[model samples]
Target: MRTHESGRLVQAALAAITAAAAFGVTACGSDDSASSSSSAEKPAATSTPAAESGKITADSANKGKSIKLGSKNFTESIIIADIYGQALQKAGFTVKYDLNLGLEDVANKAVEDGDIDGYPEYTGTALTALLGVDPSDVPKDEDAAYQEAKKLYKSKFGFTALPQTPFTDSNSLGMTKQKAAELGNPKTISDLKGKSQNLTIAASAECFKRTDCALGFRKVYGLKFKKEIKIDVAQRHEVILKKKADLTVPFTTDGAIAANKEVILKDDKQLFPPYNVTFVLSQKAADKLGPAGQKVIETVQKGLTTPVMSELNSRVDLDKEKPEDVAAEYLKDYL
Candidate 1:
């Protein structure tokens, strides 16, 4: 398949921030970052000839051994780690956690060093941050992105990029509902072309430099802001809610978007890369766990949808519920 390959050079610089994505993220979860009102079809468990049922019981699936699970330092990552760790435990694997393990760089190193087995990851992050692919080269179609990433991880690091969760946590441009209405109800990024001069934008501090954010607007959509402000992910939504910025970048699954009732602009240009969550397992660990491990991981991925994940995030970000507890509650249904 022909891949978009512009901005290949800028990927080197963006790679650094992609590793240190240690800051908290606010996303609504889905390959679709715009219009949280829509839901993607939930994926079924991974199909492997190793088992008749989609789920494989851990005890029957693998020899008794310990699996070291790791996660980046964020609520969503931690919660996902627990979901996988806890499920592995139920399957009778001696699961140990290296949770809150800094950033994707740290987690990627651990996996490469054989210090851990696997953890959930975003397809775009793994593609750009780990595999050195240009963001423009990333496939916009969710499954295409996953397939491209799967091939790269297997070839580059001898790792397996398992089937991704239906939910994605991609970046989005959002404005107040009123602001969107004032612009004649523009829906897609292309709609903002000539309107950029009237719009003030805000995004993560790195977005100013990252091609995926502000830079993507100019390069991909031909839009340039009248003014741009840098705000941490934690406060980006507030800037939009307060009308201080006409448009702000927020993760598609960010709980704040729902909490603040903001409107997300569609990325009709297909500029941003897919951030669909998937489990990237080392070839060694995957060989050891076999189909049973695939079942465990796929079950977790299959159960999560955009709305379900958003609520899970809300429990941690808004309700102050522990990620572990939230993970436990969500796992009960699948396990």
Candidate 2:
């Protein structure tokens, strides 16, 4: 659990002032009079307060309030949590980060137990994982999935589900370009029919049981791979890169796909349900945020299209940048 105070802007302002004072002292001691004069004439640097500089404005109603935000333990979730947390901080709400809270069930419990005020959650995950809805029963349409999840959350947990992002990060089968070429460049999962018999597939342990993954491949596509390897979710791409597996289960918006390190086959049969993200908050927390705070979250998320999110994920997964740093940079456009 990590807590970020709203004092960051205050610290930046102090630093700017200190730098300006040092510049002034240096100008007074300069041997070059003309250079000193030029320096003296130049305006001192200023630090703009986030609320003033950013599209998200501080609301008087949100002052003195704090929101605890959490995320599932994944690159995309961490980055998204940071983005929402930082944006709320700018809007006069003291934002606390309780990130890397493990999987959907863990995050759901955290919010329910008040360990976190809210967190980002995928629509399909809410239905299939938390709500106990079968994968086969999950809605295929993105909006329909979000609405069902939203309705269920409200009735079951008194949670408020915010509008979802444009991107849907559903489960997908991915392979290297070379591997795809060897398989005759199959464009869809159905195309892999007989070829799967010779392929070694890899995925997280749970995926093997889930209807949206290994089970789906066998039941929906009639695929029977030569071997099924249980790997860590984070290592799905690595196994493919190392040629240990011919195919791996990955999220549609995985950074590896964005980097072209792996290519996702189209899910023509739509085995996986829509997994668009939305902020789920406790009713009390939602009331605390009010309309202004809600607007701030919605506004910041507006720019998170699939490609944009993939690139942000790539910055963390491929470029080795910190999630918080990537989020801060992303918020710059809104700011």
Q: Best candidate, TM-score-wise?
A: 2
Tens digits of lDDT, candidate 2, 1-335: 12222245324333433221111111111112111111111121222244332255556666678788878878888888778876776666766666777778888999999988898999987898787788889988899999999999999999999999878888899999999989889999999987899999999887898787777899999999999999978898889989999999988887677566577899998888998999999999999989878987776776677766777777777776677766776676333
lDDT score of model 1? 0.70
TM-score of 1: 0.74
RMSD of each: 12.7, 12.7
> Candidate 1 regions off by >4 Å?
1-64, 181-184, 242-244
lDDT of 1 by residue, 1-335 (tens): 12212134124323432221111112212221111111122222222234345444436444456677777655677778777766666555666666666657888898999878887888987887778888888888899989999999989989998889878888898888889889988889899988998889987655666677678898888887899887755677778778788998887876767777788888887778888898887988888767766776776556566666776777767666667666766654333
Clashes of each: 8, 0
* Worst 10-residue lDDT window, candidate 1: 31-40
